[model samples]
Target: MFKYFNPNKVFFITSKAPKYVLILFIIVFTIGLIESLILSPEDYKQSHSVRIMYVHVPAAWITLGIFSTITLFSVFGYIFKNPNFFLISKSLAPSGFIFNIIALVTGSIWGKPTWGTWWAWDARITSMLILALFYGIYLLAWRIYQTQDQAFKVTTIITILGIINIPIIKYSVDWWNTLHQPASINILSKSSIHESMLFPLIIMTAAFALFSLLIFLMKYNTELIKIKNKGLDRL
Candidate 1:
């Protein structure tokens, strides 16, 4: 089964996906910007500054989502001896790290106006920062290790340990006294965010997801090329 995942075979299919993804990304992102910036209503208190939530929330969501996916791929790759999984995980890290930074920066920008501070030791904020650190360490492991086996094992361990932080980050606001507000969107119950704002948030999230997919394809293709250059037929 894993033989079917050969880099050559995979590249033939995935390499063609980026161009289409890029087109869709541009269309969705333009719509997201219009909906978020021009259509979404201002918060009763925060006014225009509230618009930052469109970016901050979606970036945070993407960061967490990507890390979870990285963890799954790493664990499964290690268990199944699938080098392709590691390649995919490695390709995903750049986008995850990028979104983590975006979330943190935009959070800080949103904070100055909302919390009246540029930075704080709030639980959610602190946990998010820790998640970003884990992303850094995971990416660093790939570069620092000389062998694929070594990198795979180390990154798997890092992701397994890092996943424990995900729950903490999700529940930090509820479990502690934090400047960060509790979640506005709930899966099992009615969300606090109005439909107008929620619609744009969802669109922005979709746009961001497409962008990450575009990045992953580009990185994955490069890795495949490297494998080909090394005269390897399969990953």
Candidate 2:
């Protein structure tokens, strides 16, 4: 099944994906903005400031999802001795890191009006900051290590350790006192959020996911090109 993971087999398809993805991203993003900014009802308390959720919530969700994906790929790459998996993980990190920062910044902006402060030591906020640091260290490991094997081993370890923070970030609101609000969206049960707001949130998340995919395709293609030039049979 994994044989199709080969760069030679997938390069043609991957190379052609960005333009189509970009068009879809533009369409979805435009709709999401219209729905979130104009159609979605304001919070009874927060008013228009609640609009920040359109960007912040989706960015945070994508950040967490991408990091989880990176860890899975890194672990599988190590176990199977498949360098291609590591390459995919490497290609994914930039977008995840970017969205992580977006989440933090937007959250801070949202916080000022909601929490009366721009920064806080709240559990969820601190945990997310920690996650960003882990992302930084993981990216730096790749740059600082002298060989592919060394970089792979170090990054695998970093992700393994960093994943411990994911649950902490997810549950911090429930586990302790925090300024951050409890989750309005729930997967196992009915969400507290109204359909009026939930619909736009979903669309925004799709737009962000498409944007992340676009970034990954570009980075992956660049790596593939480098491999082609270096005469590597697989990456």
Candidate 3:
């Protein structure tokens, strides 16, 4: 079972993704945005400001999700000596970094209207800041290293070490008396949010996931092409 889902093989296979996958991603993402932003109802308390959650929460989720993915692939690359794993993981770093920044900005914007402050040293916010910093360092390793192999080694190490923060971000509210709200939509609990609001939020989260996957695949393909062209040049 474990061997059935290898990251190296998965990356290599997706490098040749069919054209339809791209088309489907575009269609689904567009529909998701429409349903989330236009069709959804406004919150009773926050009014239109609640729409920010459609964007903010999804960005936060993707930021952490993508980083965790990169870390897993980085570990696989290190243990299996798989170039594909490293390449895919490296390609994902920029997208994850961008989402992290988006999440932070959107969170701050949302906070101003709700929390009455643009910024706070809350555990969730600070952990996200740290997550973004980790992404920057990971990208810096690629830019600073002279060789691809050296960059991969260093970045993989950094990615693996950065996994420690994933839990911190998730449990930050619990660990500290933070201003951030506790989880209201966990698997264990029936959603504390109203259906009117929850529907849009779910649509937006799905859209964000699709969009991130689309970008990740595109970037992964671009990296593969670069590697191939470099090999050809050497030849």
Pairs with backbone N, CA or C atoms under 3 Å apart (clashes), candidate 3:
none
lDDT of 1 by residue, 1-235 (tens): 7777777777888999999999999999999999999999998888899899999999999999999999999999999999999999999999999999999999999888788899999899999999999999999999999898899999999999999999999999999899899999999999999898999999999999999999999999999999889997666
Off by over 4 Å in 3: 1-19, 232-235
Error of 2 at 198 (Å): 0.6
Per-residue CA lDDT of model 2 for 158-185, tens digit only, reads 9999999999999999999999999999
Across 190-222, the per-residue lDDT of candidate 3 in tens digits comes to 988878778767776776776677777788777
Clashing pairs in 2: 84-235
C-alpha RMSD values across all candidates = 1.0, 0.8, 3.1
Return the number of clashes found in candidate 2.
1
Worst 10 residues of 2 by lDDT: 226-235
lDDT at residue 28 of model 2 (Cα atoms):
99
Best by lDDT: 2
Compare candidates 1 and 3 on lDDT and give the better one: 1
